[model samples]
Target: MRELACDVAIIGAGTAGIAAHGAATKAGARAVLIERGPGGTTCARVGCMPSKLLIEAARAAHDAREAQPFGVVAGEVRIDGRAVMQRVRALRDDFVASVFSGLDAIPEELRVTGTARFADPTTLIVDDHTRIAAGSVVVATGSSPSLPPPLRPVADRVLTTDTLFEIETLPESLAVLGAGAVGLEIAQAMTRLGVQVTLLDPAGSIGGIRDPKIAACAASLLGDEIDLKLGATVESAEAVGDGVRLTWRLESGGQETGTFSRVLAAAGRPPNLSGLDLAAAGIACDEDGLPDFNPRTLQCGTAPIFLAGDANHERPVLHEAQRQGWIAGGNAARFPQVEAPPPWPAYSLVFTDPQIAAIGQAFDAEEAHDWIIGETSFADQGRARAMDRAAGLIRVYAAPDGRLTGAAMIGPGVEHLSHMMVIAVQEGWHAATFLDRPFYHPTLEEGLQSAVKAVAERTGGTR
Candidate 1:
């Protein structure tokens, strides 16, 4: 067997692995990046890009459909699913090519590609043929979509986020198994594209991570276009002729049934730890096959193996994955003297009808505490009103002393809103000061000020 050596070996070339390679090399460590398949993130090829492409198509179609309402009567807005698929395919190809080209821009000495499995603590078998002896190893292997038991047998018609992207045509109707970020986004996007959609979740409301009021507002915006099966679980789902049948139990233990042309399983994701041979490296994985590592350092049980990204037992958001990757890469480069990376502040965005974004601890924490809470409806935002869309809300949560604990926004421009919150959370910005900071007039940013003022009022800031 051919053998090579490096200071660090990073497995999985998704967002985390890609970031780790650059960070490690910048830190002056020799690193090799190994990917089992074509290099690009789920966000690149499947999750974010293609999904958004589909959504944009739907949005255009929606606007055309509404043209008549504005006294500009037009003929039917028809969509050629094949053309949509073609555009998405071209975009996906370009995205993959761009990522690979960027990876190549790194010093040639810092990258390699192939499947890699642990041979031992500091050694790996690459592509089951070549061996790599490294000083330290970082596992950035990301997670895979979780498919529940009742739906697993229908893998042919039922799809995961990864599989749904490859489909050539849109389904006439889609049943989404989870109302979390993935399901909600696709459900609404597909609904806008003229597909009948149903979204089911075991949680009491959709976007379970967000505040209840925010989630409810989002659901309201979705309207009757998509049927919501909140607080429901599928008891069974099977192919019935050209469509599928689903029997579910509601939160109240009441039985319910439904049918659709396609089923999408977006329940969640489990870490990709199956073939790593963690046992050979003396690393410990939990019953779920995820490494038992320190959240701060990502150090697996022992002997220089570290976990990053979805492998570290956290929600698999891209930001968290990138943070873990950078931390693990830096730690691997520095070895024994490496100080652990700080605890990552959690953050994420759910891209449903009205996108839901949050930062810091999720809003459902059980701390009994004094808080300043404020909300601004999208109706109040000038930009949203101008866009003819005003069906969302923004909220800020602050401690009794006015420190920003968390912030969430469910509406248009959420991606931009999230960028500001990331800085606010990281800087520990005082709710009152940041909220009072000058905001561009008639913009969604006004929502930030409104939320801050609301929280301040709750904290008796007026006094």
Candidate 2:
């Protein structure tokens, strides 16, 4: 076996792994990056970029169809599924190419195109041939689409975020399992694109929004565009003809059945720790196969190993993954002398129409006594009315002392509005801080300002 040495070894050339590689090299450490598959980050390949492309196409088609309400009657709106998917793939390829170009800039010897398994606490074997003795290792292997056992038998008929974008033509109808971010986004997009879509979620809420009101608003809004089945449990899924037949039990103790041309399983993702042989490295993993690690430092226990990105299963969002990657890489490079930065406020967004956003501590009814609630309804907002998209709500939470603590919203432009709240919550800003900022008229952001002011006034601030 060929032997090599490096200061840091990074597995998986996805977003987190690439970020770790850059940080490790910048820290003056010799690092090697190993990737077993295509080297594009998930965002560029399947998760974010391509998904957004399809969503944009679906949005345009929906907009054209809805324009008749404004007296701007366009002829029958038609979507060529093949052409639409082709454009998504074409653009997706460009994005993936850009990522590859960046990877190509790194020295060839530093990049190994093979699977890596732990040989020891500080050693890795690549494809059982080349051996790497590293001072520290950063595992950013990311995650894989996880299908429930009931759906496994019909896997060939199921689509996931990882495989949905590869289809050349859209299915006539689809059954979307799970109403989290991926399921909601794709389900709505597919519905708008004229596909018969049924979205199922075992939870009472949708989009994983913690705030009950926001979750309700999301379900209501999305339900208008798709066949939403909340609080439904799938009993079984079987292959029937060329499609899938699914039987589910509703929360009301009733059974429902559906046969669809395809099934899109967005259930959840499992950490990609499967062939890593972590036991050889003495890394203890939890029942979920995730290594115990510090969220602040991204270090795995006290060992010279670190876990970052989706592999850690802490915060699987792209931004959080990149942030964790940097932390893990830096700590691995400067082992025994780690730097732990102050944690950033938590933030996440669901990209469905009337986007759902959660920032900082999500609102909980049981904890209502400790928080002051401020809210606004987009149904009456001037901007929402002008756009004919008036639906949903925004709720802001503050402590008795008037400091912005958290917020959840389901409304037009909440994606941008939530970022503003992220900054305020992270900076420890008071509700009055948002109220003091000027809000442009007939804008979605103005609705956020109104919500903040309402919260501030309720919390002893002068309006």
Candidate 3:
């Protein structure tokens, strides 16, 4: 077997792995990046970019169809399924091309092309050909679609975000399981594009939302567009003819059956840790196959190994993955002298119409009982009314000290509104702070401002 040595060895060349390599090198460590498959970040290939393309097309079709509210007369809108997929594929290729360029620029000698598994804690065997001994190793092997046990029989029929966008033409009908971000977004987009879509989730947790009000708001609004069957668990999934049939038991113990041309399992993506013989490396994984690691430093219990990205199984969002990757790689470079990265406040957005968003301390775990909640409705907001998109609510959660801790909303442009919310949470801005800021008239900011102002008034933040 070939022998090699490096300061840091990073498995997986996706977003997190790439960032990890950069940080490891920047920290003065000789780093090797390894990949087992075609090189490209998930965002560029399927997860984020291609999904957005499909959503944009759906938005255009939905807008034109719903334009009667704006008193605009329009002709019949026709969706060219072939053209839609073509554009998505073409643009997706452009994004992938850019990512590939970055991957290509990595020094050739440092790039290992094969699957890597732990021969020991600080040692890795790449496809049984090359043995690498490193000071530290980073497990950034990205996730793939984890099909539910019931769906395994009809695995080919049940698609996932990883395989969803690869369809050259839109299916006539699609049954999406798991009403979280991926399912909701895909189901809604497909529905708007003239496909028969039924969205179901056993947990009924829509958009990964923790705030009940916001979840209800999403359930109601999105329920109107698609056949949303929340709290339904699939008991039996079978391939029937050209479609798939699903028999699900509802939360109420009632059974319902549906058949569709495609079924997408968007419930979750477990980390890709199959071949990495972690046992040999003295790493212990929990019930979910995730190792104990410091979220801030990304170190695995002082074992000179780190977990980042979807592999960490914390937050699968691309930005968080990349953040964890960089930190993990840097720490791996300089083990024992590990330092946590500076903290940043939380922010996540779902690109559904009337975008859903949450910023910082969303569910309020141990401090739940202490949060002072303030809210405003978009039903009467001037800007939302003018735009004819007024149908949602915004809630801000503050500590007893009146500092803004988090905000949840399902409203027009919540994605844009999340930027300001993130800033407030990051800077530890109090309700009084927002009261001092300028909010223009006839704008979405005013609506958000009203919510913050309410929080300020509740906490005696009014000047």
Candidate 4:
């Protein structure tokens, strides 16, 4: 076999792997990036950008239909599914093109186009074409959507993020399984776009929300717009003529059935590590197949193997994935002297109406008895009332010493409001620091200020 050598070998060229290559090269290491398919990160192709495009279109339709409360008559709003999807695919192609421009710049000599399996701790064989010996390796193989076993029989009618966008026309009815971010966002968007949608989740929560109150508020608001089957397990799925028939059991042991033109299995995304012979490289894995690694350093045990992005099975979002990739690549360039990257506060946003935003740590009910709490409902907020869209909740948490701990919110514009809390947690800003700032009245900022003022009061700040 042909032979190649490098200081670092980065497997998979998704968002994380791309970042890894830059870090390794910047750290002055010879790095080879291997990818098995046409190069495009998941974000540009399916996850973030394209999905947001569809959501934006859905918002336009929903807004026009609901404008009567604002003393305006929009008459009739019609959804053109073909036109909507055409625009999504067209703009999605542009985003993929932009991403490819960067990938294309990588010199061919440093790029390997084949599947790679570990031959040893520091060696890889690429589809039997080339043997790569490297000082260290960074695995950023990313992940793929998982189809639940019960739904396997009707798999032909089931779609994943990987295949959802390829449909030429939107289905008249869709059954969305798993109410996590992906399921909720798609369910809401499709419902607004005039599709009959039913959202089912075994978790019994709307959007993986930690705060039960906010979760309930979100559920109530969204449940009005679509069928909600929380705490239900799919028992059987069958492909009927031109559609799917599904039977599921509720948490109370009651059975229900449904038929839909399409089924979206947004259940979960397991890492794409099936073919890589990790044990051959002396790396150990957990029962779930994630490597035993130091999260801060991104190093696999004490070995020179590093895990980054969704493959690590830690935080699967793009922002954290990109950050971990750089840290892993830099450490792989200087293996034995690996260093931990500086910590950043954790946060996540779900792009559902009455958006769900979680900042810093997820709230733990068992440990929250000692937390200083502050909250406000948008139903009474000025801007929300003025917009006729005020029907959600926001809550913040703090330590006794006044440090802003975290927040869980469900509100119309909480996606934008949550960033301030993200910065507050990241900078270790106290409640008093927030109270000291001037908040303009008749705005969402005023609502946030009210919560801040409550935190300040509880922490003994008179301001």
Off by over 4 Å in 2: none
lDDT of 2 by residue, 106-189 (tens): 999898889999989899999977899999999999988988777988988999889999999899999999999989999999
lDDT of 3 at 198: 92
- How accurate locally, in lDDT, is each candidate? 0.79, 0.90, 0.89, 0.90
Off by over 4 Å in 1: 67-72, 106-113, 365-369, 458-463
Name model 4 segments beyond 4 Å from true: none
Which residue pairs clash in candidate 2?
none
Predicted candidate 4 versus true structure: per-residue lDDT over 80-162, tens digit per residue: 99999999999999999998789888888899989999999899999999999999999999999999999998888899999
Quality of model 1 by C-alpha lDDT: 0.79
Model 1 C-alpha lDDT per residue in residues 1-463, reported as the tens digit of each score: 7788898899989888888877788889889888887668867877778888877887788788877645788897787888887888888878878888887776665556677788789999988667999999999888788779898667677889888878888889889998877788788888888788889888877765557777677777775568887889898988898888989999898998888899989888778888889889987766777667778877775568778887765767777788888888898888865667566566788766567888775676466245566778888677887777777888777777878778777888888887787778778877766765668878877777777777777766632
Off by over 4 Å in 3: 364-369
Query: Which residue pairs come into collision in candidate 4?
Result: none
TM-score, every prediction = 0.93, 0.98, 0.97, 0.98
lDDT of 2 at 326: 90
Which of candidates 1 and 2 reaches a greater lDDT? 2
Query: Residue 83 lDDT in model 4?
Result: 96
